[model samples]
Target: MRSSLLRVGVVAGASALVLATMPASLVSASPVTDPPAVDCQSVLAAPTLDAAFDAAAEAADVPSDLLRAVSYMQSRWEGHDGRVSNDGGYGMFNLKSTTTAVPDGAGKGSTDRSPRRTASQLERAAELTGIPASTVRSDDRANVCAAAALTASYAPDLNASTQPQRWTAAIARFGSADTFERQVLTTLREGRARTTSGGETVTLDGDPTVDVAPPSASDPETDCPPDLGCEWIPAGYEKLVPSDPDSTGNYGNHDKADRTGPGGPKLKYIVIHDTETAYDPTIGLVTDPGYLAWNYTIRSSDGHIANHLDPKDVGWHAGNWYVNAHSIGIEHEGWAGSAGWFTEAMYEQSAKLVRHLAHEHDIPLDRAHIIGHDQVPGVTSGATRNVHWDPGPYWDWEHYFDLVQAPIGQSAKNTSSVKAGDVVEVRGGYADNVNTITGCQQASPGSGDCVPGQGTNFVLAYQSPSLEAPLANDPGWKPNGAAGTTYASDISARIQSGHKLVVAEVRDEWLGVWWAGSLVWVHNPATRPVVLRTTAKTVTTTSTTAAPIFGRAYPEPEAYAPYEIPVQSIAPLEYTLGAGQTYAVSDDDVVTDYYYAQSFDGSIPDDRTDVKGELRYYQLWYAHKQVFVKADDVTLLDPGKRAVVPTRLPKITGEAKVGSALTVSNGRWSREVTDFRYTWLVGGRPVAGATGYTFTPRPADAGERVVAVVSVDDPALHPMLAPSLPTAKIQR
Candidate 1:
């Protein structure tokens, strides 16, 4: 996991109206009298992405490091074929109103639909670079050139040849927030590199000695990481019914509580969400009484964080109240359906903030504790399908976790060892694991196409082990027994990366996992191994009949009788746990309780109280969402302790290429043991009659990482079966 760096900005300008839409400080520098300096032809003809930035910088007379760092922070130097951010900015440079002013939301309860609109910086970029906006939008080179020209025009204080650190105000002029500027310069100081979507490696060498003034700020009453430089724009917290002087049932935006303070609910999870709208308008809507609220809003362009509801309060963001009651919600400025809308700057900043929150609240840095809003289950059978699936398939959870200092599979200790009934994490590598990702809105039609892998966060499970079988089904996602679709929202067949489940049956490379109360098969090829062996605690149902699954772990009826409130039913969801089926545990012996908080005014009896029940529920990582099973009807199994331990693992060596001989150092155990075995794998499936000490790759194995499961016999130890780390991808 990458260390959560300090809260980790281009102002398109040389425009007028006195920096109307852009932040006043970020881009308020007087425009320079520079000529049309962008050498569009040179930028286009550059041999590499690194050379493209260098060419654009040389043409505009700006530091190449500045251009590269700003680009890195914005799009991770990715063009993505020139996609626009949710805030309507474009390209690797984020050359637009990246620092578009976020509404302060002071008069939060106001029902204002219209947010102040300003002239787009894209127009200013066009004017400064003397290029058509269409060309700037589609061509990566043109976008970089325009960014250089526009940013150079903003820095009238800095000539064509200014020190990298001296460009802070100019970077700030690109966007107003000091955090935005500092982050850009921080990228320069620390440097960064990334492989573009078009498959070109770009690097900006870091000079840790590069110095700049510390960021300035005015963050009052804000609960945020110091590096983030967040602004407190509190979501409305007033009575919705203004006519009723002391209305108990009316409230706007969020509920007030003493969470994360002296006395409050145990903060367990952090739910990630994406705003369907742009950043500024999201603030406008969240402040409105009718619209729901979340804790923070992260901007796509600059990574500026806007703190709304305090950690001490509850935001009505997640549809399930139980989840909201125990979780903190963070919203990013992007649409779930829009591919490449989430920026690297936003991911870095969000990671820092999340790392801070997780550390502060003592929450575990795992998928169970850090979840997407898409994983939030509905409160009942009817409501399951209605839950929002934001921060969708393209969220890059593996990268996000890497930034969060968890790095998904870094938690694996006994990974090279496993047996039946053990738990495993779905881990198809992001850059290579091509997935069939569809969208409810038809936003991504690239499903089932494997040319340039569109990496996703889940693995599709099939009703049978073969590729010809239909995808597995989910009762809550679809009740008609229809198979799962490729829709981003329909997570029926997708076993999200890092999700842990019990192994039901293993037939060669196909693993039959207990998913949604059924045994579904997931292909775990030895090559490009999709699942990581993990020693996680799992639980099985003790009930003779199928155990009922609940979305919420609410208090029993008797627990709420004393208060003037109706009981929150512990409704069983359509999905259930079969008697023999087991699932990985999120938490054991979770308190079965409910919070009674439905009043702005303290008119109701026992308001703002947590109702505790004698009954406890075990939280399980079941299917796409978590489910609560009664602890009394569940038996917690210590799978981790029972796993077969490997003292000295077998090894493999030789050329890992097509038709090249790859040798495995196996078959060295005592000959007395007759149960010992070895197997060679291609694309994770076993090669027929190829269980020898050495194997040769075929033409079909090219570009695929072939592997060998070297099982050694030990008469003293238990049966052990595991695969070696995948060998290098086969070469031609």
Candidate 2:
């Protein structure tokens, strides 16, 4: 819809002889040539450009053959204008802006501009002709004709060169010439010959070299139709049986597989896919006789599996032939961008299927070999510029890898020890499916919203030019949150021990690692041992002094502590700790004290005003201390002032039934459950039990929440209650 001009030119020397026969006024008019009609039915089609070439050659008084030769040189009449030249010129004729002018009638001027600055023959021709510059740059015909006329203008000089070796040298003067002239010339000559002389043609119809065989009973090479061999299985999966008793039949009707062959048993990569349609329809579509077939379809409900094709035959899944032939496609039912999260059962079953397929086919489970549909490269050289992006940003690579037991995280330790500008590999997951949250409110259970103000942090990383290279980022990223607002942060850096990792980028303290091609940061402190640093730093301490803490002063001291404490030697001083001076204590101490002073309750710290709802009861840990502070507190602890504190162990109540709400309370903080995560427990352990307060109960949980008792970390205060008195419980 945009418009621009095109410039055209011709050398003066050859003008005399060629134009002598034509009227002077006619020479200024645009050239005209017969249009080339091409069949567009096949995958490979010849481009149409006769009218454009003829006009330019005729106007320049150059041989049409020469114009054709130049067209062949530029793009082989492929009509692919987006092609980039070595010098950075884009599109057909590689026109430059210096000589091309926007056409008069073209809507906008100069819509098309080459990456290169130098004008080409096509640009000169567009200028000579009246066509707009943008049209010349984008229109195949205008570009071709303009190129021819410019080439013809140079014909005389080339003819006059006495040195036979200089023939190429003279042709090189044309702006449209390629850097590799010999190759260009050869291609031109071949194309000219093919056009002038009838050549063999390729078709997409039934092949002469191969014959389709009927579905046979015992032969493994027979063809099987869809419905006859497909049977539905649980979880929306279909098990496809080979019509031939031997199970060696080829069932695909397309060109993706070899119909006739000594081709080895069909074993290749497994293609992972997510159905854009709903679950039931996905199964119905794949099972229909006329519809497309894949090896398997996994249901999101419970991860039910179905098979529709045999491993020995190809499935019509990947758009690329090479990928289809060498890969087994498995379609998982669900919209990739839908709001719902991929069910745990579905992910588990998918992983099992993938593992089974990998073992059966000897395929390694790595990024290069196991990729999403979005990662499939273009099939042909020309197709590389146009790629499809699917299975989009919603898939969770970290969780998936964990299921597969794949390595993820930085291998080198001592992230802080690593200096700036140094290369390091940092690995972790970027929650692709996470939604952005801008307001303060309780997130629906299992919404996958990385809870803000709850210590969810993401590291910065960049995409590298080489897809295989590690990601990197500029150092120095610090974020601050506003009152009552929860900002989304990356949680990929929460690397723990036993996770898989590959070196991505090496930089001081920061490693850019790949988790599904998306770079995530891994911070390695320099103080830790290198061997211990390389592996994920799993949180080993169940009760961490560093656990975040938050609370507001009671309007009255008696409002919070209903029970009066008896005087004891071990009791801490009862002085109230200000927001800025909240402390952290060792979690391992057996008799550590907490100090709390009865004060005018209304004199709460200004930072305490930022507290909202349940968040007021928790604290954020920093540098190994349970700091009593509000989220909005601006004062930071001095480097040497941090307190060593005991770990805070989480206490869990018993599991509750599905569809029913459960309550979890630890000291002043409590949360109610309403989602799958809230009703389920993994290995009889509450999902968020490690965090000391939140609990996600599952329907099948084996009753009884495991409870642990540990000391709270605080440096400026002593225990208000006995060490064993402050405990949390999970109950329905």
Candidate 3:
């Protein structure tokens, strides 16, 4: 944690007297009051959390009652330990500070704004207690002790008082927020009972009539931006159910889900979106039960906000339910093509709201965690080609990130310099960016204005540094190797701001990146900053030819259902990275699975469920689009050295029957690679152009048996090959 105010004063005798009279929620070393089920001696002698708090309070000369009350208000007795809260707080006391470690959670690839500092309360606690930050993060007792010490240090003027009301101001001072004191006093007076993470019972008795005189602030509601017009318009779910017995539920807006459990899918992302409609209509659509629901909606006119759902529940706004389940979707009033629809007031207010929510949820303040709706991935391989692109090219990501206090260019020293294997980030200035688009139309039919607008979240990639050069090729969009276009919907060639990609080649003022399995160039201006550089690990192939790229990351074959027809082939892409080309790997070992929920209507069985697979793939920074490759395909290596080689081999899949397609799977291994290649062998002889994920037995092989030769490679290692055992003889 950064340096904080060390404002401890000389401890007066009144402090000790006040501390001696207060009743602690946990068992203490002293026998001043009736202890709970646990005895004071046993608690202090053992390494229980209660003893740590008691000792810390004693050492700091703080009242244990006050310490317990403050902690309860912050985390409700649940210590997240190493895992941080949405607001960046950690452990039982919700300590927050900054360090350079990347946040641990889902979508690791999307959060490549690495080499940035992060602060947590846990670090602050470590600083005060003189305990190692690692120990404080892992040990519950140490965490509690540190929190107690910090709280004690904050209230040097507090004296021993039996009544809780007297310590209200000091308690408030401990949290450093306007609402902290009232909330703590409220919990202290009313009392609280909770089962700690350790399964121990702790309780604080309530005092209904206790008067808590706290120093009030002018703006008491601290969670919201004071300048915005925010309202609470509830959206009812009961009306969504059908009246007729045979009819399915009409609810399509949100899910009445259970609380996210400890091992349950974690809440990792906060999606930003645009309504593409008027503010009132968007609100009406959100509240209409038949339409989808997002957590909050910000109007463009006055920056007015309407919160429709609880953050804990799932919203149906993002096309992907897996993301919807693990995210808080916030919609802004605007059209994708029109710059006038996104107002400065709305942007400021949204940033404030986002900052507040990110803090409250302990979400990391980075582009990966704070993503636009356009960034959300499709559930299946086929769906990737079509997803919402609203809050599009005009969202002003650079300015928004600055408002969130995690600007991209501030983290690294040589942010402007680029080199081969360096991770290049598109940091195109939102306001100053002047790329021309051929087509600009209003998102809504009646929204008006088809004229091209001025705003940007992307930079056009070209074949060369000059503007006359053709746009980069997108294999997924144009497989024949056609040049990319300036079409508004043509996201294939443009690099959106905040996305990190590996540099494949670099010239004087132009740098090439691996995009959609081909080298794409970003024109670097000498005067104005268009790209930033950072360090990242990448996966490359040792093959002499281009390597394949995939759309989805799926688990190995044995892990998936045998009868399940491959929804969309996880085959190697036709467009491949040139041999020796290195690209950033988003995540080397990404789980392969599909979220297969189609509707909220109960009449349709298995409507809201996930079809999971055990397969794994490596997510790569190959293109503006999210792409993946099988874990067995390439080697995982750092910038300077090669990683250890895998000892595992590949296995053949699918029935060996004639006319049936067979595939190969990478067997279990410690580490994962990408760009898997395959070859079909007929009686140990190679077949031409049979290099896809699947292969069919040819008619000419009347008696010859079939087998599959699977090859995997990366820049660090030579290609690793495994041939499946020969199948039963082919029957003519």
Candidate 4:
């Protein structure tokens, strides 16, 4: 959000205001000389935008660094052709004249106003340089030249000793915003650099005479919570060489491009992730020029934040490129199934950061926009079944939303039972909601290593309302009566919280939801239900008995050209939604297509290879998973009010450090507990007489894993035993 008050170059008529302000002593007495007549075609031939800008500046007698800084200020050096900003700006220069005129005001109705003229910036540039507006809009070289010409018009006294501050007003005019001028000056004085995805190196050294001004009106301070020691460690974008000599691999995990151009992708979501690794290691990974990156990472220990990539750039973290293109990724430091819960400090800071981003970007404050890595859609049919599920079930979506000022339970008071045509939210409370998920250490190679501290924010689906019944069937994974396991590899048997479900059948405590084309039941008793009743539009099959489901929402046959592969556009999955089943439809109208580009190939005009289909699909909230259905075969129902699941998880604390005592804290719970018992284990074997509040490890425990198990007993609730995540090999 750069302020627009520092405009010093923009003026009425064909010339800029700075031209008249030039000191006579600073002006060259010799006749003004133009470098050379290089057309847009020649400029486009350069290897990188840096080269093009350098050449343009040389020809136009403008400082190459100034031109580069101006372009960076305008579009981050992304070449956006023919796309218009919200304020009618276009191209890399973001010239306002090419598109509709948008008022330049800091806020809605203020006395201050920018100079409004009869001509647009594009028209003025064309008028001053005799270059066609179409050429300027269509060619990268032409755009650079136009930008260079503008900079040349504001040329001030020049020498090796010239201070960058002297050109601040001119730079501000180039960006048409004072805030932008500060950004340019800072970049110039501090040095601007980045390695393009195409493997080109670009850098501009800070001017020796230029010093960045102190924080002021144009360069405001970042408003962050005072307690958190926030730091801005820029991610390395330097071109890297492969460690293996024979490999041609390189890394600088982001693309420099605008997302809203005609061929450019539109951003729509913000994804949350958990770094399976710890805080320091995670920071190291992100800073490695050769590794992937996320927009932000929140330290679990102290709720510290490190912002690496700019929100405008695309980072390579999400497995799906479309999601990567459309979303900002935030990584939290914690294990998905560890006994130690996410700290409150981290949650507060994360909520504040997300709230600011959502408000600034106009992102919807709902599950649909603010999502986990598990919810990102697969790019193709084959990719859907294996999409990652991270920032896993343990993440407390309920608490997170509340901190963001959008609690999921805000509508829970208005509804009660899970009914047909109504939406239900799964509410497997984190921490204390002791859920039984089989297949942990049992799946390991030799001796399995598993612990009770393994927690998830999901509830297993059952075939009947009673817990005695077997789990529901998954047509894709366990079609032959295989039970769903808690192993990370198995996603069939559970329904995570925060997901919306369409109620198909409600029998007392049991509620059936349409899951992966089948009716799956989950225990939702009136006394301790895992789900909350909420008003939502439900979609049921229109066919006599069932409707086929699909891994993707591709277009109809007629949408594709005859030369292309036909079946690739519309392949139905092996599963189907039964006629009697009802499921919540998050969005009934969605285009069926894929943003097929896996990575940026460094095309100048952004050649995004896309696969668009003509068919329409409805997004269904199936149990804990998200799937697609044919919009044609489903009938949509409208319901009025809604309810949400409650959150309740007991907190556990203490590190599993070797030779050190371990402790567990019972978290805030909805039910009252009468007593607590503790048991310590060494290498998964229960220790004799080891039951205590704390136990110091001995030499015998060396090289063996250690853990603490706490059992809580309550009068009205079932007895629950929660284990701590095992420690590394115990030290002597």
Global lDDT of each candidate:
0.71, 0.37, 0.57, 0.58
Find the candidate with the highest TM-score and give its number.
Answer: 1
Residue 62 C-alpha lDDT in model 4: 59
**Alpha-carbon runs more than 4 Å astray in model 4:** 1-230, 234-252, 260-264, 377-385, 414-416, 438-456, 477-481, 544-574, 589-601, 604-606, 609-614, 640-732
Name the 10 consecutive residues with the lowest summed lDDT in model 2: 35-44
Q: Residues 176-273, candidate 2: write the lDDT tens digits.
A: 12222333344334343322111222111221322122211222321222211223432212213434332222222322223123333235456677
Query: Candidate 2 or 4, higher TM-score?
Result: 4
Output the lDDT of residue 71, model 3: 68
Error of 2 at 605 (Å): 86
lDDT of 4 by residue, 60-128 (tens): 555778777666555445443444332234566666564333345322234656644446667655544
- Give the alpha carbon lDDT tens digit for every residue of 448-557 in model 1: 22223456777889988898899999888888889998766678898878888777667777887788877788887665567777767777655435688998989879
lDDT by residue for model 3 (1-732), tens = 111233332222332332344333221234322111111222223465555556556555555666677767655565644543323345666565554343332122244444544445455454454455565554566566766655544443443343566565456434533345555666667786766635656666777766765434223223345433356765555445566343345556676543244422346678998877667778788888777788888765334567787665677888865567667888887666553334434565688788887887777676656887776665553464567776767667887887678886666532447765567677876545766654546333333343343446788888666778999876555656688877655666778777777665567777766666555678775766577876556776654444666644443455445434335345554445554456666555454554433344434554433345666666666566545666556666774642222224344454443344444333432223343455677877878888655566585566776665544433232222211121222222
TM for every model, in the order presented, reads 0.77, 0.29, 0.52, 0.51
Quote the lDDT for 237 in model 2.
Answer: 22
Error of 1 at 649 (Å): 29
User: Which 10-residue span in candidate 4 carries the lowest summed lDDT?
Assistant: 719-728
Of the two candidates 1 and 4, the one with more favorable TM-score, higher being better, is 1
